[model samples]
Target: MKQGGDLLSLVGYQLQQANLRLETDARAVLADFDLTPAKLTALILIRDNPGCDQTTLGRALSINRSSAMKLVNILVEKRLIERQPGRDLRTNALVLLPEGQRQVDAMLAAVHRSDTRMTARLSREDIQTLHNLLTRLGPATGAAED
Candidate 1:
């Protein structure tokens, strides 16, 4: 394939292109569960960190408080997650419901399959190197684990 000259050489452009492709595959995988990437990520995070409040989850996702609240509300409506009283009276602790757990477990496997298929062209070493390089390019500020 012919490279697009200077644009092809730009890291941001390359990352965007890669993200578009990965997101497309992810969307397809998530469709089976009727979820968006954000929702699935929220579910997984809630499952892993039971009793975590929306503020912490929002910070981890790099989203604002309002957006996080809206996401949480949607999940609550779907019966996928619940909000209980938090450590403070002002906050609500996020917890994944049984149905959410079941969905997340299946979704994890589907996402893994999708990722493996997408990276099939690369060897295991190549994938590892790519992951390491990407990690190095991540934010300098302490952000949530990828």
Candidate 2:
């Protein structure tokens, strides 16, 4: 197969291409649940971290305050999450509702299946090596694992 010259040799370009393909698969999986990647991620985070606030969730998701608020509001409207009084009066603690938990559980499995399908061409060792290399390329901050 013909490669795209020097661009094909660039790690960033390769990673972007891979990410786009993965995201496309993810979107297809998410579409069944009427969810987006961001929304599903937010629900998972809320489920994992009980009583987490919007600001904290936003930081973890690398989004700003306003965007976080909008996301939270949509979740609230969808009845997928609820905002309760936080430790501080200024912030609202986020929690996944039962429906949200159910959706997340189902979506998680679907996404995993999608990923498995995508990586079917790779051997176990190849997958592990790819994961390790990607991890190494991630930011040095421990938060990168999240």
Candidate 3:
């Protein structure tokens, strides 16, 4: 391929666009609730991985521990997440608040609409193939576990 070919044709470019769309749609979708993307992401992470602690959550989200803690702190301040002392007593395990769960459900609906619009031209298999290709280019879920 020629250097710096039109970005749209590049998978990286498409994924970047997809991510931007997700963020933009999500911010608007979440605006009334006054939630930021980072806060919403932490809520979703806790919802999907109920027993997750800061260290693990940070790694999963590809953020550092301090940043993750700051995000978690905001969620806690907003009462969107409940942080309980971990069994280790030195860490905090997170769970989504009821309101947070509702937010995630609503966000999922919005994100689904955005995804459908983004990939309207692709077949189900094409979507799966794209997922596989992206995974091949980066460390996937289990690979991120320390």
Candidate 4:
């Protein structure tokens, strides 16, 4: 008996719509670098966690091992990352090459640009509050558990 047709009033619906819009904008922003958000995220993680192994990377990225391997393969092919023998002979540790580091710096700049554009309508205080709220929500909902 609830036929108000006010879908926008639902918080979950609004969140989903906003996420979709952000994804669209992000894809456009990252197109120039031939990267998706996941790829950029992986590169940044690999850069920050030097000598990290594929299993650790996949766990951090919330992806499966196969998917992680594929991502690493693409980055290696692009000459953005390299793999070296780990402490154990069976493990391969990932490292960002100099080119990868340079690209990651550019990627950070691009992310900042996107963030600025996305939050243009919000005041700095509002943005900070929103970030705080989202940080709380993610953990509470276990959406960020991975």
Q: What TM-scores do the predictions have?
A: 0.90, 0.90, 0.75, 0.86
Off by over 4 Å in 4: 1-9, 140-146
lDDT string, candidate 2, 22-128, tens digits:
99999998897888988899999999999999999999899999999999999999899999999988989999999888889999999999999999999999999
Across residues 7-44, which tens digit of lDDT does each residue of candidate 1 receive?
88899999999999998999999997888888899998
Clashing pairs in 2: none
TM-score for candidate 2, please give it.
0.90
Residue-level error in angstroms, candidate 2, position 137: 1.9
- The per-model lDDT (C-alpha) reads 0.92, 0.92, 0.80, 0.89
For residues 14-108, write the lDDT of model 3, one tens digit per residue.
77877887678767766867877666677788998897898999987889989988888888888878888786978888888898788788877
Point out where model 1 deviates above 4 Å: 1-3, 141-146
Please tell me which model should have the higher lDDT, number 1 or number 3: 1
* RMSD versus native structure for model 3: 4.3
